[model samples]
Target: MSETINTPRQETVTAGISEAKLLGSLKHLFASSFSVLGELMQNARRARASGVTFDFDPDQKTLTVCDDGTGIADFQNLVVLAQSGWDDETMLTENPFGMGLFSVLFACEEVTFRSRGRRLRVSIDAVVEKRAIAVDVDESAPVQGTRIEMRNLAPNLLPAKHEVPSAGIVGLARYEMVEELRAYAQGFAIPVRLNGEDLPRPFAQENIPGEKTDIGFVSVYGIHRAPDRQVVMVNAHAYNVYFLQGLPINGSAVRNGTPCVIVHLDNASFIPKMPDRAHLYDQERAFKRISTSLTELVERYLVDRKAKLTPKEFASRHWTECKVFRRLDLMNDVPWIPASLFFRIGAILESSERMMDRCTALATTAQGDPEAHLLSREDVEQGKFRIWRNTPYAPSASRAAALLLKVMQREEVLALADNLPEGHWLNLCTPDCEGFTFDVHASGCAGKADYHAGDWMSKVTIQLASQAEIVINDPDQRMTPLRCIVEDDWLLLPAGFTERKAFNADLPFGDHEAVCLVIGRGIRWDHPVDALSSYTDENDEYRDDWQENSARLWNALVSGLRGDSIADLVATALNTCTEVVASECHLPHMAVVRTTLAEPGTRVRNAPRMEVVCLQDDAFWESFAASFDSAGDTALKQRLRDAFVATVRPGEIIRTAE
Candidate 1:
């Protein structure tokens, strides 16, 4: 009994398919209903089919696809999932998953395959219920080819009932099906036809000019055409489209300033994902290799072109690519900086030719070459000689200086002021003026400037005129000057001013003009004074309060400058008063006295008051009640009401201010 040993029994088990999983997969197998066309087209191409025809019968509610391919010998292979019934050559060259027919069944209620004197009809309901589909003998079937008919298509696959037939097309057919055929067969190998008309088809590689490499046929688009036929890579659209075996694969092409390059895999080693086969399989490593090869190909072309072309020409052609690829060595003698890094201020000129002409390319601080001219703070401050400036339009001079100097060394500069205090930084650059401070004291603006010298060189504190508003012409105005307004100055312009008031406010202004001193402490020569280039609240959308105050100040300045009376100012104020009554008070009709009451008058000193006419409608009353409730100033609201009811019909409420 002690010597007896119990033997443990072991049975061999293999992985089994789950019925529920298979049915679930059938439901979500194809990404798009249009994928059915692609799957069928793939089958036809892999079978070495010369031509495939698709015919739709509206009366029978069937779509027939007849292909002159090597017909199916064994009907069972069509029913068996993952069992491709193709020759070794087809299997080796194009990986087939044998799951394509399921896409047809999924899209249609019933499917019939007639090939090699045998016919098989499979119902989608039967497949869903896991029922057996039987193949039958058919003497009328095509002897050496396959003919498939899909009947009772899914609702989404049906043709539009009330659609106008396209040009040259004669029957009621799904336009979507036609479009699907066009997209899938555009780069397919075999010719495809619909309703006796040949579908337009072209291999992606054949249409593009590219060289074949070990991985694929690489083609570059968005290339500039030079006079000497040299490579120009500026302003190219990046390629996001990818192809394998003349079929498109889903790949994201990042769009940037770089050149767009398309890749069509010519090598047979590529494998597609199963089922729909719209994307690559677990070929990440293979794709990485392909990308590496593509990089090499582009690099070789650029390197070869660089040697033949001048440095300026090369930089002009492939600056974006060189920066991306870190091949700046090719730009050795190029004396130009990127326009985006510099010239976007005065004019919106983006042309490389214009940028080169208007700007002098100086060496970066890193290069201490004897011939290199490094611009100091004084050079930029003087602004007498034209030089390249950063285009970011940063708000403060310090921030802009930091942003530029972080990338390349440059001098901190200050623009000279037309009118300043005796000891202003702009006025005195003397040795004793190193630590001098200038405080700006003005109505509607306040700022302080401190000057620093020594190791930091010259640090000029920024003095922004927070309340100034003025428009100035941009610096570089070759073709046409780009209009720019200081953020605060723009805010000061009356938003709801009448045409007459706006015209009265339109005074002459420019960069070098004395308008800077009038608006704020002084002008900012470093960058544009737009709100975008300055610091402001991200959440601040509307600044309604600034309108009235800005208009008043602006009128005062304009009046003082012209030595005119307050007529224009009063007109502008009247316009603003009318706007507030109509827009804010929601008065149906409002009028402000435009003429002066004291114009050769006997006793009138000012315009008496504004007038508002109330409508008898309930909507007008509701708005009137809401305006009263929402207005913050009760006294103003009472005054508005007194002014409002002076003119009214029989049903309207009336109140006389007197």
Candidate 2:
């Protein structure tokens, strides 16, 4: 049983206000006129206003705000403006600062208020001069609510327009923002119109496109560290925040640094707000709270949610939420969140109907190389998976494909090897030789990271369990022993990883089971990943003849490693000959393999796959068997010797002359 500790009750303290001081603060308080205008509109809404209108007569250089609501009660007492703090003793929860009316009085040259049968006008000169505010009683054509107008708005104050304009205060309107506003209106049970157009709802199950498409209203309180549709996510960024009337005041792109045009909405009210009412103050406090406070809550919520929804229903609901950008901070911050979630995220990115359509369209216009199969049978049937070899988004497309492969959940994903690193990109390539083949391509260079193939295998099992072939691309320059063992349809490739390699490769790759071991250069390809792009060499030329010959040597090396005879390893020593001849001619695989043969940045296991070379200690074999007991590498030395012997051809001779 857990003991409960009691602490003394504390009262919430608010800062005392001063009228003159606050009036001077408006210069920084409202960066754009929209913020000030938004506050005034919110004030109207708080008073249960049925309608609000902003009219600007440029000819008269005056702006007028009209609202159908309870009228302002006091204008004579300046102390009324000084008592600006929100009063929460009642059920009321609207304006946090009740000084919006005074903020206007201090900002404008002259202010006029007409309501019921009374008219009050106040001039800043009169207030500063300590004169009585002018008031008049008029019974003719009495108005029930309030009408406040001002002449000569402060600089940058909004000049009211009839319709939402493209350049002025309304320019800030975005599709997401409009949507957020619509949702807020429904939640608060109010109707809001921007320049006469009804704010269409965002964040709703259904959407109706409006006459204006740019209004994006979002008051995104929080993002899910793990996105599950069954339970609601408690947003920490919303910890101390709410947007003013739930409108997105700050501009943020949908994915933060990504290319997606939408936004990741944040709250200014939930967090500490800057004096300018611009953005969250103390943003780090919010982020840290997300880590420490909400992790347990989020996990509990997920557990409860999973219990309620079927797998397909859960997946389908989650898929709809893929349009929102995944939060960047929470990925590393929360420990309970499993990396397997990224795989699901990747699926959402790649499997989107719009993206698939784009790929298909690109594939139609471009002819695929004869040796390479660009589209799979399933791809064609589904009208998706087009290979646009020349589009500007090829690199991004590859990332999407990589993400899709990363999160793939299926029974057909078979393990190829043990003790390899995380972050090796795998794809279900439809090569000419097979229906759909599994091919692995490792990105980023492995410097000095641990390799645990078994751990990765567990994750792979959870994500993709396969009954198909897996081909590992064993790059050449590594010092670590890369040996492949045939297990059913698995083509395993051992890698050259060590304890102290130069550390440059840095993007989070690795789960608890396996950390990424990077090698080779981290080359960034910009265009759509073509077969040729994957095989770029010194002169950057791609040729079929060279690829065919390299493939022959590659197949021979695999064959040699599997053979029981040491002679097979010895025979394949000419594999180095294939590499040399290939590299001298700028063969792409040769250039890649050379990284293995070259002097490593750090010392390593140094086992040479006569298939790919690195200097090995002569005594390495003596202790090699003891190094990997659980990894099942007892036969590795025999395999390496056999593969080396297999490198030499029938015409080759080795003789000692005495």
Candidate 3:
């Protein structure tokens, strides 16, 4: 028996805990005290807690977090570094790093954990000193889920609440703490309470009616108002917001007119970074995966609802989202250039009825014409034709064209023909329009080879007269009877023109150019002004001499229409006035004056009239004096000078007409 007792126990070697490293990590572990609440709440959630309750005692400087969940069974596992006490499923789903409890310890001076008829109180200094902390065990203690009381919490760790306990639970009255709790608890899985009052889940998917996916629940919030109509976001938008484990980790909902996407993630996906857990691990990769999945879900949703929605309704509701996701397939029968696009560009599209009529008329006019490309929906998709219009995202003509061609496959651009809406539809034009080198020939003149001269022969020049402006290939082109007419609902071709191999070689020498003039009535150049101002071919790839030649062509067209010189028009319209002066003409400074007009004592209100007077130099005065001498109105000239001297001050204008 002595020999058996004397037998030495086998010595086993295993990794030892490093007290020094654990102490050192305490300082760098949590970036903020707010993380203390998050970590403890997460633990409670992991324990399958139904709710979490908070209580604070100002006199004792203590915060108590109690959760009704599975009580802790092992005390040793709680303090052991890197040893998470969670089950394998919780470990895989939540990826708890066992560093969460340390965050609480880091934020508090003394933390007391009570559960399973046992209580352990540990001070931060005692842990640092490596002193033995005592755990009290008693069978008589009530058995329940975990309750943690953190004493002497770090300064400003949680916003202060009322001193008097209301109904035995302290209420977090300060807005800072209330908002902080709301931010974390709004989308939390379990219910949360303060002072026994149930906190509202304002942004939960159930309240907003979102769709459930494998990874998360998704919804769109906010309105996308158009210039002409308000488009409420009933579908989706790409303003991404990523919520992981009930907390938003990346991005936020932009409350402006654009729609915002809300994704409340499932617990099994997107693990948060350890320690602070402020953001996700591999955030970029997670974002990509989540966004991709969301896009797929949105695509499915749009497709399912497309049959029930009209093209206009669908485009209005989901145009921005469709562009963001490149999911333009849902716009099967929508117009090629929707009015919503114009609204985004700060331009208003003409009436839809009028637009449709124009398209129908153009289609009817182009019937049986060999050169006319009776564009089909398939043609628009295949990039055989492109609609060029400026949008907020696609501001340049080239970018708009490329984006249109890229997104609008198997979809018809319905603005021009095939009963599209009323707006200026853009298309690749003939050689004459592309060149910008052709001279404006007289309306009745025959086609000539050397027609590049700047000289004008006709005193009565041709101007666009009809609302149906049509530009054809040549006089022989049967699309229109006139030699040159702009397509009524379509804009002139963009400035730069590079010959594509796909075009026919037999087109007129300057076929795409605006060579001949066929003016019907006084020109309604408003469409041209809006179209050209919005759409510019100042692209680097198109042409190097575009500015010079384009301006020449534009001026020539304008001169023909208005019968005025370009220099005179520019000087009178632009050089003659300051922007402030011009703006003041419409929005003038006016003052009301009560005067005695009929009788000395009668104070009658007089109608106000405003006039802008220009201050003059000595040269102007001398000229005016000479004019007065010639016209024999010297008294009027002297009166004007006296009025300026007595009433006017530099940089100041009197509002009254007098």
Candidate 4:
């Protein structure tokens, strides 16, 4: 019984498995499978194979990629293919990354692999239940290189049928693949068959049409290896009409989708990575220098030889086409070169002579045009019409005038009173009085003809007068020796109290001439006195009296002073007065003073400390007080006043101080 119970010692093995890790690896596998062609091509390059084959069955939805590369050596490597961390250092002969093979499993349900040196064949199947499963390998018989046959292809994972058509599957007759492969193999060439057809060669030995026979040297800015990395310049015609190779890494034509000036190192390694996209314009600068130099050389050589050159000839002679440009229509997408430099070069070649002639003609015309001098003077004096220094005229007015002239097809003329001499004199004529008086001579029209009798003229004038009793009794309107005066051919009113009277005095006496007169209504001569008296009486203890006075001033600005026609001056005074008060008093008192200047309907409530102040029967003052409580500080109250004045309503009593 004791002899029957014998048992061997057991060994326990622990393996670490992470769900997140597995999911991530699976996602990478799926994404990598979509780019399987790149991987296989990489492997083919390492194997020194001329081309790689892609087999697809649309009906069955299957893709089989086979490369004539030095495949797996034995059953051991084949079994561990799905396993992570497979040693692939020795396979560095071509493919840099060994993970590409696993990416295939993501696209297909089953994968069969046969190596050249090995006699054993292995198959890998991805199990829906178990992450991945593989069959036991028979090392007794293995194939030479690697042959990967994948089945149950996910249609979505495959490249478009048109991108890698079945027709291109024939042997190495395709030139695109041949050119791509040539860069990898150096001088060695191999044939690739796709769908049983050979690929064709992409380029021939014929010289590019219209290329200049004589060699031309173009100076290029070299790379500056100090401070920061950047492209200096590239010689455009240096490698005219040459072909270049590119690696399809990460599914991009340029490195990281960046445009770069491809530079060939003396050691034969073309820098694969390009400058950042933000710095792509730097390449254009180099292109410009090269293109200019090359074009100059070509133009000099081809002088008097235009009749012998064709369109194609001209392109090849002056412009250089890079290999990247030929392989892909990248020039169309690259905004810097093809659109900028290439177009610039072409334009120069086509119009250089004509452009010079045009420039010469322009210079001569500038010296001959008499109106040019007048126009320049008008430009300098256009703003002189402003009433005050630094006053800005409406930009829209100028724009409208320019548009009108353009639409009417009239010669552009500056807005000058003297441009029409006859009209200028007529404008100065007194309509009601037969006598003619000139106030100011039109400086612009001094050299022109003078007004004569028996000439029919249309004249219009406007004069504004202050109707306020104070302004009427001020002696200027009544006792002035001269009511109107003419100086330098311009009519001026010496005693006009308001803009309306001044404007009306020159109006056509009998006939309406679109005249406008604004009678100064509520303007006052003693505004300061009235202001001080209003706050001095019962409201003197309110402490907001200054605010009320300030508000009145502000109202005077916006509403126009009762006895004055100049609203602009009143506004200026209000703004200046506020600053004066602010500089002289404490902030709270300043706030109270400023609030007084607010227009009617403007409100200023007391701060939190004064919220207990009850509202009176006057809704205006009550509303004003309410606003103060809501207003956090005096600055806020002033801002509220400014905002209210912008939209003040007529007849609304705005209480400035509460």
Could you give candidate 2's per-residue lDDT for residues 320-387 as a string of tens digits?
22212232222221111111121111111112332233322111222443212222234433424211
What lDDT score goes with residue 492 in model 1?
A: 16
Residues 1-658 of candidate 3 have per-residue lDDT tens digits of 3554576899999997679776766768677567777677778888898888877655577778888788788876767767879898888787778878877777778888888899888866776677777779956433878889898877767555544434343344542455566567666678777656777665555555576787678764432112123322333334555567766564342333323566787767778876667777887787677767866775665675556666545655565556555665455455433432211112221222322232322231244432232334444456554333221122122312211221221123222222222321322221112111121122322211111322111111223433322222322221222223333222222223222211122222222232223234323222322222222243523332533443344444544344455445544434423352435443322222222224235566443222223444545555666776777466777776666556644435459876
**For candidate 1, what's the RMSD?**
16.9
Report the C-alpha lDDT of model 4 over 1-658, residue by residue, as the tens digit. 3567668899899997774456346534343334454445545645545466666565566656566565554434333334322235423312233345555556566676655533332233333243443334446323434566777775555334234334433423233433333332221124444555553322211211122222221221211122112222233333232221213221223212212222211112111122111112243454364355444443443332224544333233222322212211211222111111101101000122331222211111244433222111122234211111110111111112111111111111112111111322212221211121212111121111111111011121222333211111112221112122112111112222232232113322222222112233322221211111223335434334554554454344334322233444434565756545433323222111111233345466422111122222234444664677764455655565556545543234458976
Candidate 1 lDDT tens digits, 535-602: 21357443434433433444444333433445565566667564544343444443332322343455
Order the candidates by lDDT, highest first — what do you get? 1, 3, 2, 4
Where is model 1 more than 4 Å wrong at Cα?
1-13, 18-25, 124-139, 159-174, 222-239, 251-261, 266-269, 282-295, 324-326, 335-392, 395-658
Query: After superposition, which runs of candidate 3 have C-alpha atoms over 4 Å from their true positions?
Result: 1-18, 58-60, 138-142, 158-175, 204-208, 220-240, 251-259, 307-321, 333-439, 443-471, 474-658
Stretches of candidate 2 exceeding 4 Å from the true structure: 1-28, 58-60, 77-81, 85-95, 140-143, 154-189, 193-245, 249-276, 280-283, 286-301, 309-413, 416-658
- C-alpha RMSD by candidate, in order: 16.9, 20.9, 16.8, 25.6
* Cα lDDT, all candidates: 0.51, 0.37, 0.50, 0.32
Which pairs clash in model 1?
A: 238-260, 346-475, 395-533, 469-489, 470-489
